[model samples]
Target chain A: MIVAERKPFDEIKESIQDYKKVLVVGCGTCVAVCLTGGEKEVGVLSAELKLSQKAESAPAVFGEATVQRQCDFEFLDEIKDIVGEYDALLSMACGAGIQFLAERYPEIPVFPAVDTTFIGVNKDVGWYEERCRACGSCALAMTGGICPVTMCAKSLFNGPCGGTNQGSCEINKDQPCAWYMIHERLSKQGRLDNIMKICPPNDWRNQTPQTLIQPGYEERIESSK
Target chain B: MKSGSQLEKILTAGHFAFTGELGPPRGTNIEAIKKKAAPLKGMVDAVNITDNQTAVVRMSSMAASLFAIAEGLEPNYQMVCRDRNRLAMQGDILGAYAHGIRNMLCLSGDHQQFGDHPQSKGVFDIDSTQLINMVKNMRDEGTFLNGQEIDEPPKMFIGAAANPFAEPFEWRIFRLAKKIQAGADFVQTQCVFNMERMREWIKRANDMGLSEKAYILPGVTPMKSLGMARYMKAKVPGMDVPDYVIDRLKGVDKKDQADEGIKMACEQIAEFKEMKGVAGVHLMAIEWEHKVPEIAERAGMLPRPQV
Candidate 1:
């Protein structure tokens, strides 16, 4: 889930001060699950913005809307009609949604209400810790399905770093050393020998995209085309 | 267990009265906060300085309340348990009292996912009830949880919240009784829109001999528009909105809803204030602080006695 904390009203206040017409857009996916950037949050942000603007010398009220999902083109298309109506777009979506909104509506400036934190799962109602880095590599199979790219603080491919003391990371005592966890899991599986395998760094170009991967097969098969 | 002399006067006076709330600005700008508090300093008896309300992190509530007190506004430092544990909570209660913030309101805060920090873990080592008791133990006995008496125990008039409109209606009165038993000196309830249900609850409090003992102030936040009324009724947890309110909001013109909201709030306040066991009204007004005085006036709760 895309975890976020609501930006304080004053920070958001500065974002929409000069503008009279505004749109507070919420994404109803990962952010919603985490309770950050969702429809209800859009309402709250709208209310906060409304109050902040109303307090200003010349107050402004924002028009609000929520998309089913902000990252998807089809979902974003739903906002096209109302978005242009506003001078600024305050997005409650993740970074991908913010960029997608910017790309979709190049004329309208979009602002993020939430800092797009890493992808993670909710341990409970209020906690959502980050677990994935999306490093464009898959080494979990060799390491008991624990991707050191995302888990290990050092991303050590060989084995746990010396900083892993008593299963706790040196970076922060509260966090369990991810490599140690991997080692323990692998040890249980009699696959601790996998730690000795020498590994090379992953190539990064694929993640940025050489070109948009519009499915050629979806449009038309090569034989038919 | 009464903490301070100033608070002793307010509580012992029977109908416990006089409190306000201050909204911490989204940023750390002092001037920005002054503008927000410009209207609230003297007019309201006490102002609740929220600690990261809705779990949306902001300036520390304790620091802000201390600042408000410096500016001559009696600050009711609202302490939440979502971010702090028993140790920090104990420290804060004592700290607020030393700073001359005579009042404190305890709450189990909204989840952090609702706030800016979605990944931050929540420490709910104590709920609002436990926190209330912790403060009470410190205030009444001057002893820590470990049974050691401090040289000088902090003096703070403690308060807790009651959402009579939030959950199963049957549970609210029981909860209120429980909180009072836990040493809650006063109870400032969540926003009360429907007075019919509230009047009955007030009657129940009186029947249970609680009205005479505890201070129950129904919360009132003026609605800016019909959309807000409906939104709050549906969205805000533990908040109750009657069909008539929704009906009135629906019928009223968009431009005139604030007036309707004020009128509705005044009517609710007037009715609540007159009930046999009622204490007073706690007007939240959200960010519409400007409307609070008017609502208080309309609700006929103004001209508060100088206790």
Candidate 2:
């Protein structure tokens, strides 16, 4: 899921300093699962922002709202009438959701209240780790299902580096070297030959911003036509 | 002559080759390099120019290697994956080779956290194994990493580092074998302060027939003092300095500890010379280059073979 963290309190306060009333919107999808931008997080952040504003002169009023998902226009339209009541909208979703909110309501100033970090998975209750780089081209098939692009510090496609000590990485002692795990996994599966095949340089052009039409939707529309 | 490198010729000639290390000055001072290499010229076959070792910034290894070549000393140019991407790394290979460097050592480099710039990002576009393979591709096939044809690729005798004392010790040999399979012509290990651990690693390497594939030279760092011994044992990661070594260093007088360290290094070299699959000793007298000649002579490795 997409992982994100709340922006620093001071930075958020400064971004909405000019507004007298603000709406804090949270998404219930990936950000909610990661505990970053959920309904409960929206309340907490709104209360904190109110408290911070109260400490300073000319305090602003804040209203909290959460939707099932922020990326879709239908889910965001639920609060269309009340959204104009606030001076600005503070989105607690990932980058996509924040941008979608701005595009939906072109009049109100939309601001992101959280920093989208990466596409990651929750390791534990409060711990999250990045698992995918969304490089547009995946190499998990050859790497024994381990994503080196996201796990390896350098995003190297080849085998482990010399700094791979024990099973941990040289950059951080706590982080396991991704390539080491790849090597071990491939060796266990008797597919060590996969590691020997040199991967070509990554073609990053596939990652340019563009809408990807779902093939399922496309096929359905064609049959109707 | 695979690459016409002095170290390659010496190792291939079936001699107990002796190599030394030279850590370039932190600043741009060629005189410091000349002074360091001067004492190591006649005593060792080739000198390894460390590339910002330990992540503390230093004169570029390529420039220092050219200085070594100018001083009539063969240089084993060391490069790390911590600072450059594939394009820059490949470009440096051509640059270093054009400047008359014949030997190249590929390493993953120490983490930036250990160096002065802890906040800096590490550019490990390729690891040491990949770096070795890339260099081999350039040298053997005359092609860049992108598979593009090069007019004249760099001709280098490639080397890589190994650590026998790292955790999951059993996997170290297999890593070395993988490095050899990746096109490492020679392997220099992390400093061997723990002879028992090194012996076991060497035995496994020989048993696996890794030596037949590449030259394995055990790294030896002469402890300048008891403090150095303790620092390596306590602070340095992956360094397995046994308790007895510290006890032995503590047993010696403070003033005599340096000599004791040299003596201990000589003893290790003498043993490594006879060990099967061991090619030679890579003396890393960190900041104590003057002691190398003395240690080599006492270890019976003097009068380096002229290949």
Candidate 3:
């Protein structure tokens, strides 16, 4: 899931101070699951903002709203009427959703209330760890399903470097060495010979911002063009 | 005679080689490089100029190698993948070769988190294995990584590092084999304080026939003091400083610890000469270059073999 963390309250407060009415919009999908931006979080932030504004001489009104997913235009349409009442929108969503909201409403300035961290899995209620970098090309097959591109400190394609210390990365003792795990997994599967093969330098040109058209959707892009 | 480097000639001629390391000063101090290279000249086969070792920025190994050359020392210029991409790496390799550097060690450098510039972005576009292969192709095929032909290829005697003490201990030898397969002409191992483990790793490399494929040089760094031993054992990653070594250092007087460290290093060199599949010893007297000559003399490695 796309993990995110709420930006500091001070920064969010400062961004919306100029506006008299600020609507805090939330996303109900990835950010909600990660416990960063959801309906309840929007309420909490709205109440805090209200209290903070009241403490100051110039008080600003804050409103709250959440949609199923801010990335979709259909869910965004549900808030079209209320969005007109606010001078600014403080979006509590990932970078993608925040941009989508800004695109949906061109008049009101949209501000991000959370920092989109990474594509990760929720380890616990409050803990998450990154698992993939989406580097375009994947080498999981030869690497025994371990993603060296994301796991190794140096993103090593070949075997572990001299920095592997007791099956852990040299950068930190808690982080397991990706190549060490790959070696163990391949050795168990009797495919240790896979590690002997040299992996060429990754073709990083695939990482450019690409408009990926799925195979069956190519005709749609052509027709639209 | 790959690159016809002095280290390569010595190793190729079936002579037991000896190499020392020189860490470039943190600033542009040409005299520092010359001073460090002074004692290593005529005492070892070649001197390895480290590249931002331990993540601390220093004079680049390529530039320092030229200074070492001026001091009558052959330098094995070290290149790490941490700071440069393929473009910079290839460019530096060409420039180093143009400056008469024939030996190069490809390494996945220490993470930038361990360096002075902890916030610096590491550009590890290619890991050490890929770097080794890239250099080999540039040397053998006379082509760039893009397969474009080069007008003049850098014919470097490529070297890579090996750690026999790092864990998944059983896999260290296989890693060494993988490095050799990736075109490492010579291998310099991490410091060896645990002789038993080093023996096992070397024996396994021999069993896998890796010894014949590449010249293996076991690294030895004399522990300057008891504190240094403890720091290495506790702080340095992948370092295996045995309890006995620390205990030996602790048994000596505080003033004599440096001498004791030198004594232990000499003893290890003597054992390395007798060990099978061990072609040489890379003595790294970190910041103590003056002691290298004495250690080499005591170890009977003085009057370096003229290949």
Candidate 4:
């Protein structure tokens, strides 16, 4: 669930001010769940943009289209016949989908209508809040299902911070101190002593400085060649 | 404060003009009532404070408008029957006029579930058409929904919203006519975009001979950014956007998209001005009030008529 916020109209209008022919592409995946990139959203934005810029270009350029998912090659293929007609592509998908569209249709440029926020789930309709950080690691078992890395704000692994008050995080009063929740969960499960063990100031290289993984099955063939 | 009849003006001028919109809070904070009403004053001829817009509970429309008038922004008391019934609706209409709120934007309102409170019960006393007719009866005929004559009729400017870009365009046109026939003095449409479709809708209005019978104001909200455009199109009901607009959103740097949005909106408003049968443009610059003057200026719609 890649959460994203729809950019304001003025900013979106400026991006395409020069182009007469434009195609709005909607993705029906992570972006849709967060209410940013969806078919309905694509329709609304298309209408809005027209109302925003009443001027039309020669040969009558400007229209809208939606794909099942811009990230997937199959969906991109669906728009194959009509791809060349569009001068530009406005993708309502996540950053990944935008790049995929760029690669699929290199002739035309792709723009983002949403500020891809993070991976999160809809608490309910019209609401989505961040949850997981997707740190490429799973430590839910030891931490009693709470990922202290993301929830702690500071990403602390030890017990509650010295400034934690009434189980609230010192960094943000609205947030529940992740360590406190971890402590309570671990204590209830008779694993409170796990806090005594040190994991050593996590290897900075593994935690940050950027890392990438190549597919073992696919990339191995290329490397071997 | 003697105000000429908006209805009489519409009927006489053959075309009427009015700036329409509901006032949103100045900020997220809600500490004092006066702090809330400060910005809306003297900005709009009549401030329309919606009843729990977005279904998110805040201040009641009536109470907020009551406060709005107190602060000197002529309040257009939007009375939606989404949460009230025939009895309550009639009572509120009378209540609002008593409160000095003369203008109204009638709506069926977004589903309560769509708002923050999903479990909130819906009280659809009457659909927007029936509600409009009811108010018309009270205003013109001085009769309640029950056919009882009132000592004094409520004087209100009944304004309705239509979404020209609503899908299955035929239905949208048909509904707009229905609202006008039901005695809507003026209409403030859902944000207009897709100029071709709006032109088509206006053509349909011409066909229906409503090209002159009613005041049809096309709604336009300048998309402030690509992100905001996405939110409105995806989140709002009965909103439509074409692929071209979305594609236009593409190829732009995020940091610069806002400027792009403003430019696009100016062009749209200019085009809207050119279109025949379009009475006016309802600018819904949700939270982007500061940029509206620039939008109006650039669109060549600066120095808006003194409505």
lDDT of 2 by residue, B1-307 (tens): 6698889999999999889999989898888888898889899998999999999999999998988998989999999988998889999999999988999999878877889998998876677778888999999999998899988888999998998887656556777777788889999889998888888888898888899889999999999999999998766767778999999999989999999999999899989989999999899999998888788889999788887
DockQ of 4: 0.01
DockQ score for candidate 2? 0.36
Q: Comparing 2 and 3 by DockQ, which wins?
A: 3
Better of 1 and 4 by TM-score: 1
lDDT for position B13 in model 4: 54
Off by over 4 Å in 4: A1-225, B1-20, B23-44
Worst 10 residues of 3 chain A by lDDT: A203-212
Please provide, for model 1 over B60-163, each residue's C-alpha lDDT reduced to its tens digit, 9 standing for 90 to 100. Answer: 99889877876777788898867886678877777777777777888766656567887887765555666777777887889775678866787677788876
Per-candidate local distance difference test: 0.73, 0.87, 0.92, 0.68
Candidate 2, fnat value?
Answer: 0.32
How good is chain A of candidate 1, measured by TM-score? 0.88
- Superposed Cα deviation of residue B270, candidate 1 (Å): 1.0
Query: Which regions in candidate 2 have their CA more than 4 angstroms from the true location?
Result: A55-57, A106-108, A135-146, A152-168, A171-173, A177-211, A216-225
Task: At residue B190, give the lDDT of candidate 2.
Answer: 90
Chain A TM-score values for every predicted structure, listed in order: 0.88, 0.93, 0.94, 0.86
Q: After superposition, how far is residue B265 of candidate 2 from its true place, in Å?
A: 0.3
Lowest lDDT sum, 10 consecutive residues, model 4 chain B, at B1-10
Candidate 4: RMSD over Cα atoms? 27.9
Q: What share of the true interface contacts does candidate 4 keep?
A: 0.00
Give candidate 2's iRMS in Å, 1 decimal. 3.3
Expressed as tens digits, the lDDT of each residue in A5-32 for candidate 3 is 9999999988887899999999999999
Question: What i-RMS does each candidate reach, in Å?
Answer: 22.5, 3.3, 1.1, 26.3
